[model samples]
Target: MSSTATHTDDDLMTVPDVLHVLRPLSKRTFYRWRETGKAPICIRLPNGELRIHRSDFKEWLDSHREQVAA
Candidate 1:
């Protein structure tokens, strides 16, 4: 398979990567929210790995902003 195909098929991202994308929030805060069920829902892959979809995270952020504005 081509490199793009391989990467597209494996679009899962790690917690650190998500943290990098959503900076201003500490890694410890993310982990704490994850543990407390306050973080965005995550997907558990067949290999027992955890990942957060970028689109879902963005949706969560938008909804949260709306809630705060209300």
Candidate 2:
């Protein structure tokens, strides 16, 4: 799938999927953010895998947007 592809809220994104969108950022940093409550909220599966909802990720990204002077 292309990086620009849109995902529904029901779509669960894997770590690689997020890493794909957040290129140039390391997995270590991603985990660090997750640890510090700075990353998008995630769901832990019974098998101990993490999944992030598209909506939550979008919301997290939107929250970080810096308003610029027009």
Candidate 3:
């Protein structure tokens, strides 16, 4: 199989990467979302680091899409 077949698995993102893209203004705010179940599904590794699958993150972002008045 070509690498593209595994692209989905290779695109997992860390919390910092997600925050960088979302730019929600603060880590506290993101943490609050996680705590309140407003954020996307997050995976907690046995070592304690958090992970978010790329597809799940995109779905979460799309689900919360809102237009802001420019």
Model 3 stretches with alpha carbons more than 4 Å out: 1-10, 67-70
lDDT of 3 by residue, 1-70 (tens): 6665444744779989888998864778888988998988999999999999999988888888898999
Local accuracy of candidate 2 as per-residue lDDT tens digits, 1-70: 6779765888999988899999978899999999999999999999999999988999999999999999
Best-matching candidate per lDDT = 2
Residue 55 C-alpha lDDT in model 3: 90
User: Relative to the unseen true structure, what is the C-alpha lDDT of residue 56 in candidate 1, on a scale of 0 to 100?
Assistant: 68
On TM-score, the leading prediction is 2
Candidate 3 lDDT score at position 39: 86
- Candidate 3, overall lDDT? 0.85
Residue-level error in angstroms, candidate 3, position 39: 0.6
How much is 63 displaced in model 1, in angstroms?
1.6
Per-residue lDDT of candidate 1, residues 1-70 (tens digit): 5565333423666778778878877989998998998887789889977797766676667767744455
lDDT of each: 0.75, 0.92, 0.85
Which residue segments of model 2 deviate by more than 4 Å? Answer: 1-6
